[model samples]
Each structure stands twice: as structure tokens, then as C-alpha cells.
Target chain A: MLPVIEAGTGPFTQPPTINPAVTADWLVAFLQDEMRARRSVAKAVIGLSGGVDSAVTAFLCARALGPENVHAIRMPYKHSSPASLADAQLVTDALGIHQHTVEITGAVDGYLQLEPEADARRRGNVMARVRMVVLFDQSAKYAALPVGTGNKTERLLGYFTWHADDTPPINPIGDLYKSQVWELARYLGVPRELIEKAPSADLEADQTDESDLGITYARADAILSHMLEGYSNEQLAERGFTEHDVRLVRRRLDGTHWKRHLPTTAMLTNTAINEFYLRPVDF
Target chain B: MEPPVNLDHRAAPLRVAIVQSKPRKGRYEENLRELGEVFAQLTAAQPAPDLVILPEAALTGYFLEGAVYELALDARRFAADLARTWHEAAGGATVDIACGFFENAGGTYYNSAVYVEVEHGKHCVRHVHRKMFLPTYGVFDEERFLSRGRRLQTFETRFGTMALLICEDVWHAIMPTIAAVKGARVLIVPSAAPGRGIEEDDELGSIARWREILHATAAEHGVYLLYAGLAGFEGGKGMTGSSRVVGPRGRTIVQAPALGAHIVRATLDMREIDLARATLPLLGDLGAVLPDLLLDEELPLPRGLHASGH
Candidate 1:
């Protein structure tokens, strides 16, 4: 079986080595290759939530696409903490990328007036989707791709909003863990204060990811790594994870499996759109 | 309603029966006896079937990977014998026989399907298709003993252009599509699908999805689909045996009961396929609308990217 990405014929003739470690130079070359092929000016549009993951993703996109091509947007609602705005601007200033601040409090309020029966959870999701709407609007204006900031931890747990904070043209940070994101962020010169701040969804006051998941990032990462490595249930239990914890993670993984899928449609032909087993990529 | 006329172009509907049978505990003779009994019962009916299909690995149960070398035989002998006997029983009814066989040639074993046709005092195997796609994941270990077939072939049967596929071969989307594209009116799939757990849904969504995918493939390529699966316990694993026949409209026209060994028959209207394809125009429009990632003979990794609606 052949590999997914075909090698290029250029001064850099050798194919890039794929591994767990991601390098700044490799990202630059990959972006250059995709941009040249697409024949569009490379640019990044980020939804800056003042979270470490977004901060790290924005910085990486800036380096690859150039700070001039990188654009950051801060979408704040009425309930958003002032510190989130300050931290978002701070990171943008440090990276020297053009920044835009969009207040979505009115948008949310106007939407609610039309449909006030919207519950809290629905309201929060609407805000995230609205923020993405604005970012994608910027993408159209600049012919840029909306760069995703979701980390591996968030993805595994299905923490990010679908088609909102999660949807992007490219996802450089998606494969990295939350713990690993901090390491890469520090390496890429992200502001230490932003990196050090406790992560929050900022949908409601003091709502941390750990609160909803019922486990800290440290514990979630360890169990997730074990699962990814195909460790048996007995092996995980012997290694100190309780059955409840393991089952919870498994159930969460299964429940959120749809997040990893495209919308299911009825297949009416021999070649199904969802039949990925016969995929050409060498595995 | 206008006065009806029998058009010469209107071919008679072919009666195809998928014998979803339970093979006796590695006892090849007993399994053959069970099949003979079922065939007798099916053919004795008022409107007898034109063709009968058995599951892949039907002669021998879903034996473990190592069991293939231990149990596989020169299937040509058994298939030839069965065809001769069945044709004699049909009393010149001209029934075609298709069944799973263990093909051993030059000391290499293959899980294969053999189609035997006995015409005018001459008995011969019409087509032999080696199971091409082998399942290596989870409970399946087909790749261990069977050599993967390199080509997809079709035969012009009395019914229509018939394509033969053993279990995993249907899982290979490209091969089946290619076979259908090459003018196979009815695609026959012989499978040994493991039975669903007690807690599982009665309909078995996965099996239904498999049917949907196969039916869609058939509809897209203007063909009918016949799937015959094993039933009851085979080796330590339970065989589901919910084999079905899906028409071009993506509906299950005939399906065997959940766990029993039985033969289900359905009349296939092959002519409707050309009309369906003509009306829908999916096949003609497909090449113009497929995504760039999906244009080549290989599937794309569906990484949640936009399809871009090509």
C-alpha cells in the first residue's frame, strides 16, 4: 500500500518523516506545499477563547503562515470574564498578529428573544457556534482557513463544540494532548501567564473542563494513553485505574463516536461513502 | 390498463434461494446431508428455484485460522458431485448450483465458491472465485490460510450476468463496484457472519447496514444483490444466518429467520435495474461529481473535512 501523502519533486526532495514529534520547519514546509497547490494566500483565523489550547494553536499557525497572514478574533459574550479578553489580547500582541474583537452578547440576546425557550446548554452551544460564524466570515474575507485549536485531550473526551470551536480547515494541535500542548506552547514562546492559567470553557462562570468530565487532565491523559496503546482491562485495573473510571471513559468514547463521523446518509450504491476500510493509505 | 402483451425482451424472473444452513460440528458429511435435505425440500416446491446459494466456508464451519489446512478439501469433487445429483433430482428443471468449497490445488488451500452447471449430459464447474478480501481484524483470521484472489470475474448465468463474492470480498467496495460496473445483474455474496449477541438488537443494525451498502452498490451499478450467510454455531462462534436478498430499491425482499437453518427465495426482476439507473442517473452523474480525494481507485481517510460537494 502507498502512503497517503505523495512525496514532492523539489529542492527538498526527500519525504518528511512522520512521527509523534512535530517540528516548526516541517509545519512550514507542509503549509507551503498545501498553499501552493491550492494557489491561495495562506492565512489563519483563530477563535481566541484565552485558553491555552487556542493560544498554542494560534502561535503555531502564525509561525507557519507568517504573523502577517495570521489573524485572531476574540468573541466575547456578556458573561465572559474580563481576564479572558485581557489574556486573549495579550497573546495576540505578543504574537504580533492582527486582532479583531467581536461582542456577541447582542447576537445571543437577539437570538434568545426570537427563541427565548433556549436552555442554558443550548445557549452556550449557540454562543460557540456564533463565534465560529464570525471567524468563518473572516476566513472568507481573507481567503483563509479557520485553524482549529482543539487538543487531543478535548477531542478524545468530545469536549469541543462540533462545527464551532472544533471545525477548521486544518487541525495541527488536534493530535497533541493538553499536557503536550503546554510543552509545545512554551517551546513556541507563548506568554507564560496565558500558559499557566487554569483552562476554562467560559460558557458559565468557573466552569472547568474537569468539572464536567469528573476527572483531571492528568488522570484522563494517563487512562487515554493506556487505551490508545491497547492495554487490556485487567492491565489497566492492575495499573491503578478503577473499573468505574475505565468504564466511564469507554462509555464516553462510545457515546461521542458520532463526533468523529460525518452525518450518516443512506447509501444507495456499491461504493458507500462511509466504507473507509478499503482506503488507499498504507497502514 | 391497456391490453397486456408478453414482450420478447421481458425475461422471466429467476427464482434464487439462499440456503442459510448450520453445518454440523466439522462433520463435512453431515453438513452435506443437511444441505441435500434442504435442497430436496426447496426444489420439491410447486415453483422450484432456478438457483441455490450456500454460505462461504459452508462445507466446513467457521474454523479457526489453523483449521483451514486441517479441514479444507479439493472442493471440485464435492461441488461436481452435488451439481450432478441436484440436476438429476430436478428432473431436467435446469437448476444452477452454487456453494462454498475448500479449493486445494498444488498443496495450497483457498476458501472458494464454485458454480456448477450440468447441461445436456455434460457437468462442469462454471466459475470458481477465490475469496479475495480477507478479514484480519477482530474474530476473523481469513488472511492466515487463504490466498487472496487477484481479479474479480463475472459469469453469464441463465439468470443474467452473475457476479460471485465470498464474505470479505464484498467488504472491498471497489471490487464489488467494478463487478457491478462490468454488468453483473445479480451479485451473490456467501458469508459466515457470526451471530449477534443476545443483548444485540433483533434486526442487527450492522447486518442491516451491510445489506444497505450492498443494495446501494447494486442500485448504483444497476444490479440485484443476493447474500447467503451461515446460521447456528460454527466452531465456538455462533453463526447469525440472517441471510437476505435486497433489491435495487434498497429494501430486503427476502430474509431468513434469525437463528435457524433455512432457505429463503425471492424472484429477481433484473429488468427493473436498467430502469432504476436510467431514472436516477446516479451512475452517469457519479464520475462528474465524485470528490478529488475519492477520484482515484482508493478511498480517502474521511478526516471530518468538508466533502466540498463536487
Candidate 2:
């Protein structure tokens, strides 16, 4: 097989280290400014999914927007793990933020009944979309903006539903990698159990995130982090990564390029809509 | 006066390390420990750096609000300990460290920078500069908490004569111009400027402005300029760290990215200063106009009506 990594210089030989306290400060400021400029809202609504990404995002928003203005929504289906709900409650209670429990089973089942033969992919997508809808409803009633918790890893590997989990107007954790999410979570004083627990999409029965993706977070993050920092597959190999691991990650990263960008428009005019008359959000 | 020596001869490269320190609020012990570790790493390397520069407010950190006075260091006492620590880490090796801190002298606190030269268990407090311009507008309130240094003096070092400027001091052209005129061949600035601006191409507007200012002054004076910035998040402000080293010709020798902690090292030739000053003689022009810049006595104003606002 052809060498996966490009034979060239890479971003760094060592991994990137994040200072959580500093990252927390940056995230809080970013959330406050983005909320005021983008939506004109002082309140934020975040989904607490017993995951590090959501927990960090929720904590940052609460810190930035204040606990009184922040609301944590727990949206679990009938098949979702009870542990997940308990873990989310742990987060809400610790932050002293408002909490709401809205079961997505009813909303998801309504769509699933029309397609009884739908597989795991279809059912998981429906659940994600349903939770998003319920979160938005709460956002309107509470006068808060929904905050996205989907991280860079999931986005890069195309692990999330197209427009379901990725629909939030603002996100503080989107730029961080999965490993970085863990680091930030620990730094924010998140409970040790939450950080230690195996990551899962909570989409199907007996499902684990790494098992389903056929890649581990340690390996995946190492490959993805260096690659994002300008390292090619060939460079990663030179830095002590297995050839097979680098190939797998690059393939997934290369495959997800279309998903990362805005929908390409067929240019029929000299002034494309995205190219002309643009204004900064703050402006 | 001693005879002037040829600056173009005896060619040896000067190595400088500019650290973008990630300092936390009100954590003096941690910050000191971190600096010690930074020193160990630098000294353990082959051909250790000639000088290491750290960011302003590195001891107590910026944005302390009201707790700055309590955490301020006694300049004389702190320098003794810092010199000992430097001797232990880089002993038998010569390395000068320049860092910013809050200094408490005679019950009065001031934001100051101290330069220490250490070699084989001997260290000296060569120069101490109190910040002249204490900004009090928009994210800066130094004047309310600390006293300002009334003097700007340049000191001589083994490598060359150098000057130090705290964060906001470099924003004004007068500061750099004064240092250059005071016989400083190399000017160092330690800053803790918060990165504030809309995201565009992932570039910071404030960082860009700093680069431009440093470049203009270095080129005009034909001097080597090194900038060391603090990087971290504290009190809702993101401290930007885009430290850089500019040559006498104002060309960037090496630079680090924004918003990250990095130890930047670059080799600079001292002869470049003479080459640049020889080519572009702005210093000579400034020297000729120095007399006109001063006044022996206040001038009398002509009798005129003081206008009142409508």
C-alpha cells in the first residue's frame, strides 16, 4: 500500500498540553461575548449527556452566563442508560444550575413508528434530532441559547449525525479534541468517575464509542492532534506512530472534509453569496 | 572615559530565550517553581542561552484587582532568593534573567522589572526599572494599586547595554526612544496584553499591533529588540503570547504562535547593530536635536483672553 502520511515536516514531535484554568477563562469570555453579540441572550441551555464534552461546555457556560441564567437539559430515551442520567444529574447539582428532564423516547418513537424496519443508524439519528428539538423548545421558553457539546474528534471522524447534534448556534468545546476535553474536564473539577467512565454515544444497547469506531481515544487523538497541527501521515509515522493507525486516522479525516465545510454552491455569478457583502457578527 | 572599541570585531552570537509564561492569579510559589523548571531546561542544553526574558507581572500576575498589595514582593529580599536559585540551576554557567514582578519597598508597592546576572554562585542586581506609565483605562488599573518609577536608566551588561520596558511602557514610542538614546543597544519588553478582537484568519489584532511597533522602533534605532509576552487565561481575559526576536534591520529572527506557552531561542550577532546604525543614522539625528528638546525656564505667555465654552 502507498504510504499514508505525506513525506514532509510535521507540526511538533511532542503532544500539545492545555492549561485548563486558562482554557476555562477563555471559554467563559468567549461564551459571554458570543451570546451577547450573536443572540442577544444572557442565558444558555446545554444538554448534559454524562459525557466530558457536555459537562465542560455546561460548566463554562454556567460560569460565563451565571448559574441563574444557565439551564441543563437531560434528554434520555427509554433505552438510554440510567447511569447516564445519574451522571448528568451529578453535573447539574455540582454546578448549582437549573436542570430539566425531558425524555426523548416519545418524540423519537413517533418518527420510528413510521419506519419500524429502521436500523441502529436511523434510530440513533432520530434520537439525536429529537433531543435537539426538545432542547430548543427549552431554549425559547427560558430565553436561552442552546450550546453545542460536539467536540472536534467526533466532528473530524463524522461520528455525529449530519445536522442533529451539530445544530447549536454556539459552542465552546467544538474546537477542543477528545483528549483535550478530558484534560479540560479534570481541570474544571469534574467528578473523577465521569472522566474515568468509558465514552459512549448512548445510541444502542451495549455500545462503547471506541469499540464502535474501531479506534481508541489515545491513538485517535494522538494521530488527529498532530495531523491538525500540520503533520502528515508520513510525519506521524516518523514520530513513532504505527503505520496502520496513521492510515486509518488519515482516511477518516480525509473522508470527513466535506462534512467540515459549508455546503459548496455551484458558482453561477461573479459574486457568490458566501464571498460578497459579508459582515462580522460583532460588527 | 574609556576608548571606544570596534563593535564589528570579536564576533560571537548572543542567545536569548523569551518565555511566554502561563501564570495563574495569586500563585506566587507555583509561578516561582515553574520558573525554576524553565531555568533547569535552558541550562541543561548545550551552549546555554546568554539571557532569558520573562513576561510582566509574572510573580503576582495581572488583573489582581485588589489583592496585588498583599502579594507584592520585597524587591531586595526577592532578588537575593532569585539569585541563589539561579546560581543553583545554572551555576558555573553565566545566564542573566530579566523578569517582571510587583515590588514592595518601604511599605509602597510598584510594578517593576529586575535584571539579575548569575554565574558560579555569584549574582548581582544589575538593573531595576519601575514602570513609568501606569495605565488606568480599559482592562488596566495599575496606577490605582502601585507607584510608578520616576526614572528611565539604561545599564551596561557583558553582552551589550540593554533596557527593560514593562507591558504598557512599550506602547508609547517615547519609552523605546528614551532607552535607545540612553545607550541601550538591545531593548527588551515584557508584556501581559489580553488578546481582544474579532477572530479573523485566526490572527490577533493586538498581537499584530505589537509586532508592528517593535519592528518600527528596532529599524529606526538600528537596535536588537526582544519581546516576551505572557500567555494564559485569568479573570475573563485571554493573555496572548506571541513572543518574538527582531534583528537590527527589523527582520524577525524567530517567533512563536499566539495563545501558547513557548520557550523561544534565537542567535543574534551584536555587530548587526553597528551595521544597521551605520546604514540608517536616526540616532545621530536625534542626538543633534536633543538640545532643542529641553527648556531652561518656563516661557511667558502673551496676554490673551481665555475662551469659555459655549
**TM-score: model 1, chain A:** 0.85
Which 10 residues in a row give candidate 1 chain B its minimum summed lDDT? B1-10
User: What are the per-residue Cα lDDT tens digits for candidate 2 across A1-283?
Assistant: 1011111223333344588888899999899889976668999899899887889888898789888888999999999999999999889888999999998888899889999999999899989888889989999999989999998889988888877788898889888878888999999888777899999999887899899888888778778876774555765786688888889888889998887767888877767676675666566
Evaluated at residue B13, the lDDT of candidate 2 is 64
Q: For residues B1-310, what per-residue lDDT tens digits would candidate 2 score against the true structure?
A: 2322335422556888887788778988887777777777777876678888888887567888679877888776667767766676667787778888888888888888888877777777888889999999988888898888989988877777889988788888888888998888899888888987766565777877788888998998888888888888887789887788888878677777776678888767676687678778898788778656643234343323532222
Model 2 ranges with Cα > 4 A deviation: A1-283, B1-10, B199-202, B296-310
For model 2, state the Cα shift of residue B207 in Å: 0.8
Alpha-carbon lDDT of model 1: 0.73
Model 1: pairs clashing at backbone N, Cα or C within 3 Å: A268-B216, A269-B216, A269-B217, A270-B217
